[model samples]
Target: MLRLPTFQLHEPASLKEACALFAEHGAAAKILAGGTDLLPNLKHEIYDVDHVISLAKLPGITGFEMQGHDLVIGALTPLAQVATNPNIQKHAPALAQAASLVAGPQHRQMGTLGGNVMLDTRCQWINQSYFWREALGFCLKKDGTVCHVVEGGKKCVAAASNDTAPALMTLGASLTFVSATGTREIPIEDLWVADGINNKSARPGEILTEIRLPLRDHTHHGAYGKLRERGSIDFPLLGCAVRIDLDDADCVRDAAVSLVALQARPLLIKGVDALLQGLKLGSTELDQAIEAVAQLAHKKCKPLDNIPGDKDYRRRMVPVYVRRTLRAALDGTGPVHHI
Candidate 1:
């Protein structure tokens, strides 16, 4: 059996206390939200962490509310709740669909949205038993310098497997972070950098406390599509999220598309608005435009052999999922997946 390394655990009663503990521990400390992700990495000795600061008791980080045109969600809110919340489902259907498809019932019950947002990039070579990785001389993501996915590669290319990130990006979400120093907010799209070894930009000791999404106008329709090895309990091989805003006459006014599980960060396809704008659903032009946008997404996204599935196969499926997800958004029938 794989055993976790010994570590000091700190349960901070307040968000302030949690930030303080993190500040004190610095790089030696890791934050514990749901433990669905962090605990497995801990058992694998991924970080050599010496301290774990738990946010279980941290106040003001576990609820949802609406303030004017914003849907404010506490970072600690469970994925299960995010999936089923009426407010989220109605206002941000893509996010709700993405949350519902994460892992399985048990994982969703425990994993928090913040944990998913802060999910570490994953690679086939790195997320293995210590002995397995050690025998293979380790990869660049952890102990060694070599990158298995790219020959003589200088940097890691671990895939970002978060389902909610792309959906959040499509909805124009923002995140609030707190630290001993102060509090700051940034657009969800700005939270990620291209580096796969550690994909997030949240400074060390900064705690993500809240997620805020703008109230989408009634003209907005969205969906999330996932490609995985199974119907549930598996990370996506490829994930697509789409948003289509329609005019009063049911013609596309604007559109956005984002794809994940490809590289270090989720990809937001550009020029989608130009392609789909002013096209009414059920028209030949709209159909052709969706195909065109999918082709554009395929061109921009290049899958590597960093995660599960053949990179070529995953790359080929990009346009398929993107087209289907966009169709689902237009039909208000999201979360396209193979059961």
Candidate 2:
């Protein structure tokens, strides 16, 4: 039954208390929000801990307001709220679409937007427990020093499993982080680091308090596409999010494209901006842009053999998803609408 080891559970009423608890417990303390990922890992003894600090009692951050043209989403907001929020759908369609595709209804109800964004990802070899890992001689994400997904590699090979990161990037979002020391904000791209062990830039005592999304005008269009093994309840093998803003004359003003599950963090293709320059995102133009985006992403990402999909298949589908998602965005077909 993979029973979790006994541990002290601390429920803090405020962010201050949560930070203090984390500091007190140090590396021995684990933070708990939606137990969607942490609980299973605990049950398998992936990492031993003495304390579980709960962030449930803390008041959930909500309310979408305009700071000039920017929209702010509270970090503690639930996935269900983000998925169904009409304000989000109207302002940032790509983000709303990604929120809707995260897991199923039950998970959406219990899981939170902050938890989803902060969640640590997995590789096929790294997700197994101590016994399975011991048999495999361990991986860099766990106890081993070498990357099992890539033989003789020194770095961990866990994939970026977040559903929201790519979408938020397309919307030009930034994250607000609060810690025992102070508070600061940085672009979403900056929050993720290159190393899997520290993929998140948040310190041990830090908390992600908010996500700031730049509001899209009526001229802007965006979409999100997820490729998974099942109809639902499976994490993405490959995913893409794209946003484009056009002038009144239908000329491209700006473009953002991000791909997920390909590496330790979401891969942003800045080349899309150059490819989309001064042209409308029609089928022909989008095709060329997708090719450019795919090539850039392929160069940046080195997908491991650990996950389910073939490397060649994932590589081929990068352009496919890029083309399809961009087309859907241009057509104003929201993720929910396409489903």
Candidate 3:
């Protein structure tokens, strides 16, 4: 059995106390939420930490409710709760699907929304036992300079494997973060950075507190599609989330497409709305628009051979998955078929 290294545990009673502890410990401190991801990494000796700050005792960060015109989800809300929340299912079914599809039932019960959103970039070489990584001479994400995935690469190429980020991005979500110094809100897309070694843009001292989703109208629809190696307990090899708004005449007024597990950070496909706007859903022009969006997705998503599934096959699936997700969203069908 793998053993966790020695570390000081801090159970802060409040968010303020938690922020203070993080500020006091600085780089040596690591935040512990659901522990579904962090504990496994700790057992692998992926990174050493002198302090483990638990957020369990902090109140007001573990519920889901509607506030005015927005859906406010506390960051610490469990994935299971997020998946089953009636309001979320009604207003943002794509997020519900993403949350429900994460790992397995037990993991979904234990993993928090915050934990899922802040999931670390994953690579086949690095997400292994300590001995396993040591035998391969390590990678840039952990200790050594060289990246196993790329020849003489200057940066790590681990892929972002979060299931909910793309879904949340499609829903126009924003995050609220708090720290000892102050608090700020940023669009969900801004929460991710392009660097695999440090993929999240959250500062060292800030703690993500809540995720806010804008109000949706009757014409709005969304869908989430994920391709994984198995039916359950597997991270996504490629995931696509799409949201589109249709006018009275079935013409697309707005559309957004976001993809995960394709690169170091989840990407919002650029110019999707421009290509989709004013296009009727059932017209031949719609077929051309779909082709255009698929082509764009294929061009932008370049998967590396650092994770599960064939790199080339995963790349090829990008357009196929995007097309399927778009169809599901526009047709009011359920989640896209998983491959």
Candidate 4:
């Protein structure tokens, strides 16, 4: 049986207390919202923490609300709540869809949105237990100096495993962070640093307070697609999220596409915004757009030896998923549930 290494547990009643605990513990401490990820890593001995700080009792952190044009999602909001919330479904269907696809019903019930956002993803070389890692002499993401996934590489090549990040990113999302220092807001896309070990720019003492999603205008439509080993329990091998705006005549006014599980950070397809601007969605235009996105994906993605699917197969599916998601959103087909 997998057993976690011994550690002291601390429960903070308020957000301030939580930040203070984090400041005190620093790298020796690991923040615990939902134990879905952290607990498993601990059991595998991948991380040995001196203390586990819990945020179960944080006040003023209840649910989601819309303030002006932003749909504010409280950090404590559970995955199930976000997935089934009527407001989220209506305002940010892509995010809702992504949340719904995470784990099973029981995991959804326990996992918080903040937990999902902060979930640590893995590569084949680094995901193993201590014994396995010892045999392999460790990988760059875990302990070794060189990345096993990328030959002679300095940076960790582990892929970004969060499902919601791509969905939120495509729709122009931002995050609210609270820390002992102060509070600040930044674009969700900017939160991720390309480096694998320290992927997030969030400070050790900062708590991810809320995620702010822009209210969807009637003219805009969006969708998300996840390609995993199965319909359940598996993390994504590749995924796509797309949002686009159409004019009265159904001509495209703007477009944003984000693909995840391909690299250390979600890759945004550039020139797509410019290419789709003022263009009408039709079979011909869509075909051309798909071709263009395919070129972009091919050029942008450098799939490594990680995850379940073959790198070549996963790489080829990027444009397929991207096109399907964009087409569905443009046609108003329906929500593409990750499950």
Query: Which one is best on TM-score?
Result: 1
Residue 84 of model 2: what lDDT? 82
The collision pairs in model 3 are none
User: Per-residue CA lDDT of candidate 3, range 79-177, in tens?
Assistant: 999999988877888898889889999999999999999999999988999999898798899978898889999888899999999999989999999
TM-score of each: 0.99, 0.93, 0.98, 0.95
Worst lDDT 10-window in candidate 3: 330-339
Question: For candidate 2, which ten residues in a row score worst on lDDT?
Answer: 330-339
Q: Which candidate order results from sorting by TM-score in descending order?
A: 1, 3, 4, 2
Worst 10 residues of 4 by lDDT: 330-339
lDDT preference between candidates 1 and 3, better one: 1
Error of 2 at 93 (Å): 0.9
The digit string of per-residue lDDT tens for model 1 on 175-214 reads 9999999999999999998989899999998999999999
| lDDT (C-alpha, whole model) for all candidates | 0.94, 0.80, 0.91, 0.80
- Comparing 1 and 4 on TM-score, the stronger one: 1
Clashing pairs in 1: none
Pairs with backbone N, CA or C atoms under 3 Å apart (clashes), candidate 4: none
User: Which order, best to worst by lDDT?
Assistant: 1, 3, 4, 2
Model 3 spans > 4 angstroms off? none
- Candidate 2 on 6-53: residue-level lDDT in tens? 999999998888888887888898888778878888976777799998
Per-prediction backbone clash count: 0, 0, 0, 0
